[model samples]
Target: MSNEVRDELLTVYAAMILHSDGAEITSERISKLTAATGAKVEAYWASLFAKLCKNQDLNEILSSCGGGGGGAAPAAAAAAGDAGAGDAGAAPAAAKVEEEEEEEGMDFDLFG
Candidate 1:
């Protein structure tokens, strides 16, 4: 990915980590986190992200992507099912199980 996109995504991820941990999102905190993770980002980007998130509700932002209560799962499942169906010999059930396992293995809790 481009540096701009990577920086943007890392900033969001760091903010989410701080929000989940009930900590304030500050440019210093973001800078420390990004630097620790070895992501090269400009100081302005970290400051900008922290400033934008300061007065914003993370939950509200997430909910706006879809209904906050499990709405994304069905869409993902439907898409996967459709893809599996496109190939006649493909095992939809197995593919779904593998996908679920992969998701279960993901660790979104960056701090712990």
Candidate 2:
């Protein structure tokens, strides 16, 4: 493909990735690429972006990007609670002592 087409495609891909969460598009990101490259390129990029947004992968990406815990927080908390219950019901003191000993032996300095 020609440089013009490549640049347009890149811009579209970058825009889709950057704007995944309905972020405002700043002028600094536009650089020189724009929708005026060609009607076909513009249409293709729009279709690609639409398809990506419609897929479940977009949700996963957005959830991971949101940094708001998403669905993982509850699951992790439940698992941790279960583990604590199990530990409490079992030998807690023995396990805790071993963990402390292991931590004491861990390297404090990267070079060491």
Candidate 3:
């Protein structure tokens, strides 16, 4: 991914982490977090992102991505899910578990 996109995503993840931990979000906080992770974050972008997240409902924003805060982020956190070699193991395992769950039967049938 491009540096711009990476920085943007880093800001988003930092905000999510702070929100999940019930910590206050700030530009300095996001910049520090991303820096500590050894990634270069632009100060301007961090400030802009913090302002963007300031009044927004973090949880609602996260949930809107259809699994951004919960399941998928962790997969991305491992950094394996996005890499090609890791795809073989991660994707199949997830699919197999999902298939098994379907086989066991769901508690409620949405289509019914």
Top-scoring candidate (lDDT): 1
User: What's the best-to-worst order under lDDT?
Assistant: 1, 3, 2
Kindly indicate the candidate among 2 and 3 with the higher lDDT: 3
Alpha-carbon lDDT of model 1: 0.85
Residue 88 Cα positional deviation in candidate 2, in Å, after optimal superposition: 5.1
* Local distance difference test scores for all models: 0.85, 0.56, 0.82
Would you list the clashing residue pairs of candidate 2? none
Which residue runs does candidate 1 get wrong by more than 4 Å? Answer: 67-112
The clash tally of candidate 1 reads 0
For model 1, how does the per-residue alpha-carbon lDDT over 1-112 read when each residue is reduced to its tens digit? 8989999889889888888888999999989988989879878988998899988988888767854688788998788678878776676567788899999989678788
Please list all clashing residue pairs in model 3, or write none if there are none: none
- Candidate number with the higher lDDT (1 or 2): 1
In the range 15-77, model 2's lDDT, one tens digit per residue, is: 665576465434333332354444334345544544544434554665677556477868966
